[model samples]
Target: MDRYEGFREFVHGRQQALMRSAYLLTGDASQAEDLLQTVLMRTARHWHRLAGDGNPEAYVRRALINEHVSWRRRLRRRPETPTAHPPDRGRDRGDESLHRLALQEALMRLTPRQRAVLVLRYYEDRSVEETAALLGCSAGTVKSQTSHALGRLRVLAPELADLLNAVDPQEVPR
Candidate 1:
């Protein structure tokens, strides 16, 4: 296959997983698609370097994470105005959808790093060490971020307390 064909195959193989991670990170399907596109474009520019490495996927993931962090930093510096009217609640139906919306809202209250850490560690089911490596931070930072993120979620959505409390105790580690 030509180099372009090879690169296209590599990106296509990893696109679904990348989109899943992006969705969890952004909590918005549209934003996640945009983030994935941005990450893929940036990765394509460095495809030669990445292809030489044993794991091009890891490089792309790191680039996505870095871009997300940078984007959050820029957003933090800007003053955001609240919407005059709340989003339409008509679209939200059933208990499951409400719970998901609550979870998304709680997640939005966290810092970008904390959100990333939680998504990597819990949603992606990565070990703390692995999450730390992906984030280029210490394992302790991952633990702390997870703790803080969970705390924030609990505070922001007390209803979630029941959901967490309902977990089977035997399934959770001490």
Candidate 2:
């Protein structure tokens, strides 16, 4: 078997999902592309070792989260100020699109860790223990962060408060 065949298969099968996670992490399509590309390159380099591990998806996910957090830290150290105004997005498609945009903007305002927690727990449908494991934090930390993040989101995007409150109570940590 070709040594890289497994890596190729993995990328082919998972790129879209990985890209979605990257987009959620960076909140920009271009940045998400760059982030996914960088992580994929690194994963390719270590594919031999990673393939033997039963959970390459988890490894790649942890890498994505770590790289995103690192990028945020680096960005803080060397922030850029855009002089030009962003191009207008034109009329909202409808109430749903507007709500989605509001939620996304509110997500951008969250700390990277909080955003990561929310993405993993809610978006990815991971359990609190799984999120903690992926994040290298205690389960209690995941629970608290998830609680705090949802609270902050409620504050940041009051318009979505009803939708946020609609999350299944069973899914949220007490």
Computed on alpha carbons, the lDDT of every model, listed in order, comes to 0.80, 0.91
Name the top TM-score candidate.
2
Lowest-scoring 10 consecutive residues by lDDT in candidate 1?
Answer: 165-174
**Candidate 1: stretches off by over 4 Å:** 1-5, 81-90, 165-174
Write model 1 residue lDDT over 1-174, tens digit each, in one string: 345546788877878999999988888888889988998887777777778787888777777788888878888899678999977656568889889889888888888898898788777888888988998989888877877777677789998888755534443322
Error of 2 at 6 (Å): 0.2
Candidate 2 lDDT over 1-174, as tens digits, reads 566659988999999999999999999999999999999999998898899998999999999999999999999999898868887767587999999899999999999999999999888989988999999999999988988888889899999978899877665643
> C-alpha displacement of 124 in model 2, angstroms?
1.1
Clash-forming residue pairs, model 1: none
Q: Estimate the TM-score of every prediction.
A: 0.85, 0.93
Instruction: Score candidate 1 by lDDT.
Output: 0.80
What lDDT is reached at residue 118 by model 1? 76
